[model samples]
Target: MVSDFRKKKLLHLFNKFFDRDGSGSVDRKDFEQAAENISKLRGWKQGDAKYKETLDTLLKVWDGLQSVADANKDGEVTADEWVSMWEAYAKNPSSAYDWQNQYCKFIFQLEDASNDGAIDSEEFSTVYASFGLNKDEAVAAFQKMAKGKANVSWPEFQELWKEYFVTEDPNAPGNFIFGRSSF
Candidate 1:
């Protein structure tokens, strides 16, 4: 079972980011929009390889979400469904969500625009900003996760990403992973 706190955090992430276009549920359309936004941010025009790759990866991410979260097979993931999926993952993270790990890897690679093996606050903020999160909040989140460091390495971000999904502590830096949840 998921704690109320965890539910709140997960729902906040879904509503603020994944539920793009305020659809109230996440579907392939959200992934498409997200891919477009990210590709545009990367300055990869439509029909470009980078743009196509982003779309493909995001679609794979959506497929993973559908497989795990869309219990009804309705092609969309509701808030309840989303929270339930997290509950399952939290109970057995090691064995579940290999696709999610891939998504994280893609995001990390996307954020490391400089390809320097680490992600800086500017890079973090820029990518998150496309998700409609406040730039200032993204910066604060970077600070929280980076813990005063100038940049965060892959291992550190992996831990932070896991914590963001599983931890219920409001004060944990991972809570800011999606740029300051409303709850």
Candidate 2:
């Protein structure tokens, strides 16, 4: 059963990033647009290595999402499908879904601009801002997610992400991953 707590966060994530076109479902075009948007946000031009890398990653992420979440094999993933698919692995992820873990690492590395193992408060909002999420909310989220630390390390990031998916506790720092938003 997908508890209401997990369902709320999953829906928030879906509405914010997955269903990028506000089309109620996710398709390749959404990933493509996200790639373009993130690339543009970073000033990465067409054919630039970074741009290409992000595009490829988003595309592959979509592929992985489809394979696992498109239960009807219809090429589009609905919010329910996405949430259900996540339910299968949210508490105990498997190696077969390593893409999900890699995706987190990708975001962490993106924000850790200094090539350091940690992300500072300012860098915390990079991806959220690209997704057009409120910057102030993202900063506030970072403050909460960081738990008073000056920076969030890769290990801490992984923990927070896991908490976001699996923890039902209302006060979990991971609950603030995407800042304040109603799903």
Candidate 3:
């Protein structure tokens, strides 16, 4: 049910994080490298209190995701595996539904935010970081979607937010957006 604009935006986000060569599709190495870079960037300083804090935060986030990701008897997660993992998480986000709701609600509450009801660059970075993506890679990924434009519409936000779960619908009617893949 995503509009073309939203789908493109989501894909653009994915491209920022996972398409190292600037190709549209994500490869395994690209995904791995980004994850590693994010970790390293946040945990670079050894013996610093901030490093420990970052490590603790990273571990906490990973631990929460691990139970859901340790599928198919593998200790390591590949790109497709991780994508599928998030896809499942998006479907039933009971673990942090209230948290996510409050986060989005807070974004909407910002005065001078915008009439479109979406958070802007600074707001998105702050909120997205608070959601566990506290690194440049994460910021870049979000920027790809936000595009520094003032306020994405509510429907656009909803559509892009739900993208981790929904596949593109290729059979869209006239004037409707369709999935990128074709039969």
Highest TM-score scorer:
1
Q: Evaluate residue 13 in candidate 3 and report its C-alpha lDDT on the 0 to 100 scale.
A: 40
Query: lDDT of all predictions, in order shown?
Result: 0.85, 0.83, 0.43
- The parts of candidate 1 lying over 4 Å away from their true place are 181-183
What are the runs in model 3 whose C-alpha is more than 4 Å off? Answer: 1-44, 94-144, 147-183
Per-residue lDDT of candidate 2, residues 39-115 (tens digit):
88778998899999999998888888898889999999999998998888775754438678867887787778787
- Residue 174 displacement (Å), model 2: 1.6
TM-score-wise, the better of 2 and 3 is 2
> Which is superior by TM-score, 1 or 2?
1
How accurate locally is residue 158 in candidate 2, as Cα lDDT from 0 to 100? Answer: 85
Worst 10 residues of 1 by lDDT: 174-183
Give the TM-score of each candidate.
0.93, 0.92, 0.39
Between prediction 1 and prediction 2, which has the larger lDDT? 1
